[model samples]
Target: MKKDIILAGVGGQGILSIAAIIGQAALNQNLHIKQAEVHGMSQRGGDVQSNLRICSEPIHSDLISLGRADAIISLEPMEALRYIPYLSPEGWIVVNSVPYINIPNYPEIERLDAEFAKMPHVISFDVDAIAREHGGVRTVNMVLLGAASLILDIEDTKLEEAIGDIFGRKGDKVVEMNVNAFRAGREAGKKQMKG
Candidate 1:
């Protein structure tokens, strides 16, 4: 099995954390993994993206060429669109519908929605709101990861275990909150797939 995923979001949206969790889960399953990241002006709310590749066989490169990504897991809608050129024809995009609105010239929501609607394999939703309902805004990344998990070819229990391992240092409460957010996102993803 092989999965090439592009994770996009602004810095501080926990893009790295999502990468970490998925990376850990891949390792837990004895999969080969390669990752590359770009933290453009992250401190200034700039774009942050990561290329994560997982496979049963060995990987030779950290980068994923254009039109080869199996999935794009984004914490922001605009960021999700920004990486469309990198997604494969049959790839899935699991993204949060909320806009970060960091730029003055950000595109209109209607236009963005229309573009997303044209896609055949897209799971777009208000992950921020879901995170809030489960935990808080901090868990937004986990929520997105949860949605993406359905197509990630990794077991959900492994992802949940990785979450626990990552947040274990912070204590049980933090871990529980994140796990709850992940489950909520997973349920939402199921509904999105059905409808």
Candidate 2:
């Protein structure tokens, strides 16, 4: 199994956390993983993107070539669109519908929606709202990760285990909250996939 994922979001949205969880999960499964990250002005809510590649065999490159990504998992709508050229023909785009408007002139939500509508495989939803419902806004990244999990080669239990391990230092409560948020996102993603 192999998965080339592009993770995109604005700074401070937990994009690195998402990468960490996925990396841990892949390790647990004994898979080879390569990652490349670009923290573009992240301190000021600028775009932060990561290229995550996982497979059963050795990986030589950290970067994913254009139109080769198996999935684009984004925490922001606009950021999701920014990496479209990197997505494969059958690539899935699992992204949050909420916008983190850090720029002076962000595109309208309607326009973004229309653009996403043109895509063949897109799972877009208000992950922030879902996070609020499950564990609060802070779990937004986990929520988006949960949605992306459906398309990932890793198992759900593995991801949950990674979550537990990662957040265990913080306490059981934090881990449970994140796990819940992940599960909620997975369920939402399932619904989106169905309809």
Candidate 3:
């Protein structure tokens, strides 16, 4: 089975890091995965999108076409809304409630959100707030992944392992904060599921 995921957010949100973690985890699961990323002046707070494709078989392309995604994990509400068209009707949309201040289009952000809400099985959380509670806004992408893990089968342990692999060597503090951010979002999603 092919599982296509689109991760979208603004730069500096660790969107690519999240993509890397997910891709690494998929590899660990012995799944063949391919990912494509595009940055819009990311070094200066612009948009970033990564298209990740996973399957039991090897992938032929690095990109995912419209209506083929199994899930879309977005770190910003507006970002989530932007990818709705790329999702299959049965796909899940996991959104981080933190708003991505859409460049030059901030005024229409609210309207875009309502449009995004029309998608089926949408899950939203304030992972940014959770990250802030633990450390700072920089861990937002980890939190979004945590939230998505609750609803998807990548597994919490897989994500934790990915985090350790990705950030443990960076420094102990970063590893601690990012791991906490990921777990916080995961727990919040589980709680939401129960309630």
Candidate 4:
């Protein structure tokens, strides 16, 4: 099956990190994956999006054509909505239900889910709160990743192991904190799925 996923959010929100972690984890599974990111004005805190295509065969360029995305995982509501046109029919969307937090002078983005809720294929969650409670709010990205895992059909603990392998050597504390964050986010998503 073609697994085309987009991880989107404003800059510095760990959108790419989440994609990288997932990509690494999937590599362990021997999947053929191609990924890229649109780092538009990333340094200025503008929108950043990563596109990942995982399949049994080699993929093409970073871009996935319109209406072909199997799943979209967004770190913010507005970012999720921004990519609505790319989702395939009956596609799954995992969005962080947290309100957008941005610096002044940025465009006053509206809620993405407000529109998504009217769609047939969509799921939203308040992963930011869940991440905040476990590993400080900075870990919201992990929470978003975990939330996105629902549609990807990947085990959360595997993701944790990937995070550990990637970030563990930095320091014991950092690794532990991220592990906690990943677990907390996974649990949050699991709870949402159960509900």
Candidate 5:
């Protein structure tokens, strides 16, 4: 199976971290993977996106074509909307409902909600709030990963292990915190999927 994903968020939101964890999990499964990152003005809170393609077969390109993505995992709600053109007809959009308002003319929350409401395959929630309540605000990215995990072909344990490996250098406490955050997000995702 092939999973073409677009990971989107503002700078410092750990969008790249999510891509790394997924990429590592794919590698653990011996799957072919390609990744292309656009860090355009990321340090200035500008749009940051990564194209991740994982498949059982060989992949020749690193970029996901327009309207061909299987999923768009976003750490920011507005950032998710920015990539709508990349989503396939049946693609899943796992995004945080919280808006990172760094822009001067950010749209109203109600309007954003209305837009997301129109999508048939959207999993939108205040995942950042969930992460903040569980661990710290820093684990929001992992929370998003946990949400994305529900749609990923990778096993939960593998993703957890990848999280451990990625955050190991920070110490066991940090690793455990992120794992808990991931679990919280996963549970939320499952609940969202059911409802």
Candidate 6:
């Protein structure tokens, strides 16, 4: 099996962390993984994106071409929309429902919402809020990972293991916190799938 994923968000939103976890999980499963990251002005809250390709066979390219992505997992709503051209017709979008309005000319919420409403497969929720409730703002990335879990080829236990491995050095508390965030996000994603 193969999956092409685009992970997007503004700089410092922890999109890279999400990519790392996914990569680690894929590696654990003995899958070939290739990733390409664009860190445009990341330190200044600029656009940050990563293209991750995981497959049972060798991957020749690091980039995901237009309309070839199996899923787009974004930490910001607008960032998700920015990659629409990379989404396949049946691809899923797992994005935060909340907007990160750093620019004065950010598009209106209604326009963004209307566009998202047109997507046949979209899983969006207040991930930041969920993270805040779970373990403060630090867990937002984990929340996003959790939401994208449903679409991931890896098993849930593998993801949980990846989270533990990624945050293990930080201490048990941190690991537990992220695990909770992931599970909470997964539940939210499941609800979105049902409704």
lDDT (CA) for every model shown? 0.90, 0.90, 0.79, 0.77, 0.89, 0.91
Model 2 segments more than 4 A misplaced: 40-42
| The candidate that achieves the highest lDDT relative to the unseen native structure | 6
What TM-score fits each model?
0.96, 0.96, 0.88, 0.86, 0.95, 0.96
**Better candidate number, 1 or 5, judged by lDDT:** 1
Q: Lowest-lDDT window of 10 residues in candidate 1?
A: 37-46
Candidate 5, residue 60: lDDT: 93
Error of 1 at 25 (Å): 0.4
Worst 10 residues of 4 by lDDT: 105-114
> Which pairs in model 3 have colliding backbones?
none
Q: Per-residue lDDT tens digits of candidate 2, residues 1-195?
A: 889999998878878899999999999989999988875456467888999999999999989999999999998999999999999988999999889987889989999999888889988888988988987888998988898889896889999999998999999999999999999999998888622
- Residue 170, candidate 1: alpha-carbon lDDT: 100
Clashing pairs in 5: none
Clashing pairs in 4: none
Better of 2 and 5 by lDDT: 2
lDDT of 3 at 139: 78
Candidate 3 lDDT over residue span 1-195, tens digit each: 678999887777767888889888887889998989875566467767889988898789898889888888888777776777788888888887767664665746567667656665777767767878977778777877888887667778987888888887889888888888888888887765421
Residue 170 of model 6: what lDDT?
98
Which tens-of-lDDT digit does each residue in 59-140 have in candidate 5?
9988999999999999888889999999998899999988999889999999888888888888888897888777878888
Model 6 spans with C-alpha error above 4 angstroms:
40-42
Give per-residue CA lDDT, model 6, range 83-180, as digits (tens). 99999989999999899999999999899989889998999989988899899899999998998999887898999999988899999999999999
TM-score of 3: 0.88
Compared to the true structure, candidate 1 yields what TM-score?
0.96
Worst 10 residues of 2 by lDDT: 37-46
Task: Give the alpha carbon lDDT tens digit for every residue of 23-94 in model 1.
Answer: 999999999999998755664688889999999999998999999999999988999999999999899999
